[model samples]
Target: MADPVHKKTEPNGRYLIALSVAALGVVFGDIGTSPLYAVREAFGEHYGLALTEANVLGVLSLIFWSLIVVISLKYLTLVMRADNHGEGGIMALTALVMPSKLRRGHWRYLAVMLGLFGASLLYGDGMITPAISVLSAVEGLEVAAPRLEPFVIPVTVGILLALFLFQSRGTQRVGGLFGPVTLVWFSAIALLGLAQIVRNPYVLTALNPYHAVHFFTANGATGFWVLGSVFLVVTGGEALYADMGHFGRTPIRLTWFFVVLPALLLNYFGQGALLLANPAAVENPFYLMVPGWATYPMIALATAATIIASQAVISGSFSLTRQAMRLGFLPRMTVVQTSSQEIGQVYIPTINWILMFATVGLVLGFRSSSRLAAAYGVGVTTDMVFTTLLFAVVAWSLWKWPRWAVVLLTLGLLGVDLSFWAANIVKVPQGGWFPLVVGAVMLVVMTTWHQGRALLSSVLQKDAFPLERFLETLAASKNPPVRVPGTAVYLTRNADVVPPALLSNLRYNRAVHENVIVVSVETEEIPRVLGSLRAEVRALDLGFTRVVLHYGFMEHPNVPVALYDITELDLDPDDTYFVLGREIVLPEGKLGMPRWREQLFAVLQRNALPATAFFDLPPAQTFEVGHLVRL
Candidate 1:
């Protein structure tokens, strides 16, 4: 049977503009709101640096150039170009850099491991972004009305709970507001900064890199440690890269250069000017910069902007989890498409609740955004380092850059990444341990799941009979038994091996369906698989036919929907019987995996969304054949 053809269409100019505006809310939210707390944290009491003119200019210079080098030059110009079929992220980059044909090589294995770790670290970022962003914005209340300081934690907790609760309903309804609110936020911050910059225009001199160097030279070790706090300015850089698929390269780049970059630079310099004028304002320079009359209203807008920022990371977590599941690094969970119009908008209840609980806990435990800030940079910096490493591999192997150029470019980026990571490492004893712990736990879960699957496949392969050989045996059986009238579909991971479910059905029922199908679902590395390459169907000598369905990692696997697309097989929902092999993993008997890992895998497997649900199969028509596996 011939496959269907799907023509791709490019977005029109107006549509592209609309997407760019929408991208502002989702893509730039994290980085956009950094101005609220970044400068404040750098000059906070913990740093022990006097709020002198040199110090203020130095910090502002660091913030300026960090944004330029990390977000503008590296991410926008360099990392975003390594997208996999228009999709950008560590996972997508991993797929691009790791040689597809050489799956078992040492370099390929290491690259895949690093990529998974980087993706896992983002989960930590997701939790902290919401906690710190919301807390920092609400902290403005302390400056607005010092009397209301007592209600800060409670208010922050309430807002975060509401945010998480709203996730289930989907962001589509209020998503339209995200762009406008954020746009208002950028404009307001810009105007506020401009007012201050005009008062003390010399603060603009911080734009020079010399100020940053002199601050370090003057402060020495104390300045080096300040980079930990200074690193917070660019913490959202990874989100900008992770969310590239939502708006595409052009719109995201345009939004960053035209809107986000200018607003951020203006705000940072404005804060610096405020600090220089009133050193006492370092207590809360961001909120202090606003006029007394505008304080309450600015607080409201800052809260809205921070919530939008949190939403970006939350949505990012959902997207990352879905990608992990499709790539087989994580177990299946219930995924709801939040928007019929946008495939990227999704909600994972399990992840949402977990994040909410973690975020709220951070708020209550730390009690202030200042403390939470210590926990923030480690995950973001570690993720950046890994991204840089992976990008180097892509630049050399895939992009075919000259050896010298790749080395020079990669080493330069790596130097900046490592410096930031090193700066954050000093914060580990303070609060940075939080993300490291989170990343470690996630790494174990992902690696265990992947390893367990490999071991199970190996065990199954050892006892498996070839499909052709099994068909011959069944056909030549002395007693064919009763032949059922309806069609039977046996889902298998490996098409070359005889499915245990097929064997169990035949052995127990002593009957074979008049028409049978052996179907395998394959996930490709690309963002999407074209309809023309969706499925391959072949007829066997007997009543059996083999079907291999191809789905992109970005797509949800719907067996019923895919089956409908196979014209050669006229499938009826009521008549077809779906046979699935269900394994009960035992952690004993010397399985290749450790006992604890086996148990962990078993637990994850048990809670995993059932095959019927994941594949969107009709429960009434699906039957499971159970077996015990020692892996």
Candidate 2:
């Protein structure tokens, strides 16, 4: 595959701010919204220990330091720099680490599996991010207006529905407001912190490593409880790296280091100070930081932050779907063009509708952010554990780093990640079960799809029509270009041979001869395949039958666009007809799926959106070839 080519868009000054703000609004939502419940939950009696000055400061300082090390140094500085093409994410990062020239098919399969696990966990995270963000923010109504207690769920639902509804119409209208608005949002947190900071300057003691060390050493068991909520502080840090491609790495890194990080830390310390001054108020230190008259506005601000957080996860979901589709981890989905002008503004109708429905269910089911927090940490930590494993591989096998360095680094990450994973296990009976269930279901569907595709590909390779033999078998027919009356291009699951459809087409309509083109789409381990590295054409039967090669995935595949480069078909665009094969399988003797799960696997594949729309291929020239292969 050709490496993703990044062309820097030279926007005017107004647009530059738009880029930054849009990045912040769209990208930072998940992290920005973390403040809503992170502090409160970490201090909540059920979730953690009693809040003391040392506890608050130590936790805040730890969060601040986590953001610095994880988001700033490890990812923004190191990982994002390893983007494949213009894309950044685990999958793209996977592609970048591929040996540029090697064709190790087995390794490719392993990478795809790892990518599926990472992507699957993200879907789980997506469900939780919205639930917790919205719930936490709306729960603020209790502090501002205690009369609003019972209305929180409805209010949260209304807010989430509004957010989902807005997704169909991309983030064009108010996108520019995100960065500057979040800037103000952070400043507000800082100012609120400043009030409490003045009362307990010693709250700054958390900044000392010794305080954090002492807290952990003196209160080991209690400190472990804090790890559950404290984990939320860095929940969205992964987005900083995964989303780096959407906004350039430089801008995202800048926004985090210069803007988001400082404000978050200051507000966190301020919340600690407030907790120190009034331990009883630690139950709601975030809201208590504001003046009485300002409570309503703070509630409103919290709502905006929730929306921002939901926006980030939603967009992250979109990007992940696109990557999965390209890498062949997922089925081709209907990629709806959201913006006529911006090529990147796309909405996957299936993903959007499904996530919206799931998110709404999560909000109503969990009802409160406090409840949803139990479900949130598990998926993120699971993903981090896998990431650490991958990083270890990269260090040892890919980067060839020292053995001890790799082992030590892996141990450090695994220890932290495993602890959080253990804590989240306690929440399984609570609402946390939702993401786990979602992930498990998705994993089955994806693994089934991937396994089915692989099986079908292998079968096609075995059942494939040999072009040489096929040409010889049917060559006696005249080159009556219009006798068959249309062109039938069969799509092959395997790249090595012609599809069964082409042979079936020839057998049914023996008058034969417009042209029979066998097309196969290969998902290379790399980004994209260049022209030179594309599919090869072998003409047979005096050029009446020809094979055409489609080069790559990243480039938008318009049949019309690719057809121009295909010299095999010396034919008119309007005259060229496309045919699709829709296979109907029976359990008699077809393939290798277990008898029990075969139908489940087949149903998922059948329900998947057509490959035509997914590849961005032309619509008018496409049709399906149905085969009820009794297995």
Candidate 3:
């Protein structure tokens, strides 16, 4: 098959600025809302730290440098460059590193597993982000209206429920407001922080690394543990890379440098300055930073910002799930394209409801964002470490960067990531286990499905008849039963082998269609395939034709729609009959997979969306040819 013809169109200056503005709302939301609870959680009573000059300055310094090194340098400079056809994320990076050519090696298998684990962790992050962000934002009401304290959880739950419900309707309508709302948010937080900094100019000293160094030296283990809470400042960093394809690298980079980075730094420093002037304000420093009259307004704006952040994470979850499904790491789920123009705007019903319930449960269980913070960083940190590992591999293998350069760069980033992970690891017992458990469950599901499919494919190949032989036999048959007028489309994973559906039809019906199309839907490693290269049709002997439909991992496959795009085939939609092979796994039979895994795979396969629904095939004309498989 020919490679997709891509027309690279560079965004003009004005359009680039527009995308940068838009990137702020989607890409920076989670990190943007970190100021609400990050610093407060670090100094909470659980950590047993006094609000002294050294501690405050040290924490601020850590936040500043983490943003600079982790988000700015590591992701933007290194990881973003390793995008798979302008798509970024842990999975995309993994695809780049462990392409099909490198899949057979044991080391590459390990790399793939790590990437899947990282992607699974992101799902956990998705659940926790909305819960914590919304809860923290609503907690602001406790300061603005102490009478509203009892209603915090209820309000957070309500807001979250509404958010998830609105997902089905799509974000296109309200998406326009995201940029403006986030712009106001960043501006407001920056100004609030600036006001506090003016009162305590000495807090500016935190910009120096000396205070952070002295902090660890003075506090010992306690300071190291504080790194867990401080790590929250960069929790949204992954979203920056994940959403890169939505907004592109240049805009995200520009927004980070000009807007997000500066705003976040100013706010962290301002919080430090506030703590210095009045230690008592530590209880709710983010809200207290606002003027007495502006408290209520700030609470409302903070809520809006957090909601936006939650929306971003939820949307990302949908996109990630779609990618996983296409990559065969997950079973097919109901994927609804929410927008006509934006191919990336998608909604997965299963993911949405799962997140909704998980987020609500977290709010009710943890009660406060500070408590939830313990559960947050472990998954985020683990994901970052995996990304760094994948990035190092891509740099060395794909980019062909010098071994020494890759080692030096990876080590520097890995050191920071490991430190953060080590700090968060201590919180596992203190509620951090939630995400790990979620990630573990997802890992099992993904790996089981992948292994099960592999085993099934291997078993099928063992008994498979060569397509050429099958075609020759069909053509030379002494007594051909009948000839059908309409087309028969048999879905297959392998083009070189005969599909079971075809063999089954031939055996039972003893007939052949005038137009037989052996259809194979292939998912490429990139984000999208161009229309020109979407389908490849080759004439075969007799009335048979081989049709291959290609889609990117980020795209949804509609086989019928793709078939319609083939002008030469002159396929009539009304006269087409789609044939799908349904495998009935007999776990009792000789299969390579473990008994438990085979059972799990069976359940998963049973629950998976039908090919008629998944491929958007017309149900009335679709036929499922069942086959019993020992896998």
Candidate 4:
């Protein structure tokens, strides 16, 4: 993956402009399209608030300040600063907060759990985002011609079907147009809002905080509950931070402030302005605000923008899954590098299909964006709260900020996040349970996999034969095994001990390779390991050498490539045979996790991606030695 350092330091030029434009496409797409449904949802019948001049101004104020406070101030400014080696996202933030050494009941452990849960919540968001965005965009047909409403659901499903099917082909070819098309999206929405705002200039007063304050005082609980609807505007806030690694903080922040932020505000205010003049537009203000002649064109453009948004979220999910696998929070899964030129561009077929089915199901089930909106905020708001908590740890523990500053900053951010969370919590009975259920399932899977790996590692280390004892026994043997000609590489969890695969090979074949290399792969907390520090090699008394390959949580491990890079070893790729230990987990024991969880772990272990594929090892040269272990 390209480092963010260059993205940050690149002087003002074409490269920077290009990056900013790209950021506008990938980073801002979700929030950019919020105009389609956010205002309508605010005035939705579920809230039960009658449309009035004051209510319109108040809702617009909340929308404006939410964007400024949450998106601009918190994510762009605070959470992004906690990037782990120029990478941002819940996974990266979790890596930053997690210490090299974690003790039982340590405070940082809680932070790690929260971060994992947050990352899990993103999967829930991923499923719902595409459903809602597309539904909302397609619903514009109802405004253009009420008779076309019957085709809205079918059309939305068709567009989503095409979008998900397109995932296998990757985003490289069409990614270039994402920026220019999104640029037009922002411009079009801005113009749409400007036209309405011109007619009802009085709506401009919503920019004042007074309107928001008075709305709460006047409406009391209703105003407070309405925050749930207003939160729709900032649901994409996490995307800004998650994608900071791609274009760096500079480009994202520039795009938000200069492009996305203004366009959103203008469009949101325009919706509010339209509501003030004609409350009848409340059903679909975004489309109704569109000029009659441009209704169909706007629908087409909006659909394009929504698909782009869906693509960004889908890509983010793939990236997050890879990060989890590398960090051992999840089981190994097939990850396909979709583009040779871009390391970050990956496609996980399992995840792609899972997301597609879940998204299409949601659209078919909910049948409208408004109902889907009920299920949307819980995950995103919870994610935001987790990001804030993780950021606090980085500020105080890692960055060594003053205690008072960290406390104040955390409280201020949490105040807003918690408020939104509270508003959305009441919605769980009304479609919000979907993401919660999904998050809970994911959390269980992640925790079970993580714990299972730890237990398996402990067992392997405990049963491992001592390296000294093995060597001494080998030297003393009267009839030693015949030495083979080719080099053998045994992959193990711990490099200090004899690999079980080697022992199994020795027992089965009664022979040893002429040159033996024991390799262990370790994942670090940072984004990328420096090339110079990637490999650590130690030679033994015999023709045996111990090797440890270090990789970052954001990287893929390629053993052959790393070994070949160590000029001292002069390892030959063609001559080397890779040996891996394959574990067959059994749930017959009583000492570990619950029986159900143990069974779950066993299933996951059985289905994990093979080492030959994951490590880029040649299948013909790679061999797996299966070992059964009871938990």
Best by TM-score: 3
Candidate 1 Cα errors over 4 Å, as ranges? 1-12, 100-104
RMSD for each of the candidates: 1.9, 3.3, 1.4, 2.1
Stretches > 4 Å off in candidate 4: 1-11, 100-105
Better of 2 and 4 by TM-score: 4
List, residue by residue over 253-330, the lDDT tens digit for candidate 2.
666777677778878888888777788877677888889999888888888877877877887787677667766667
Q: lDDT of all predictions, in order shown?
A: 0.88, 0.70, 0.89, 0.89
Clashing pairs in 1: none
Model 2 vs truth, CA RMSD: 3.3
Tens-digit lDDT string for candidate 3 (346-366): 999999999999999999999
TM-score of each: 0.97, 0.90, 0.98, 0.97
Error of 3 at 329 (Å): 0.6
lDDT of 4 by residue, 19-94 (tens): 9999888998899888898888888888899899999999999998998899889988778888787888999999
Q: Local error of candidate 1 at 216, Å?
A: 1.2
Model 1: lDDT of residue 508: 87
Point out the higher-scoring one by lDDT: 1 or 3: 3
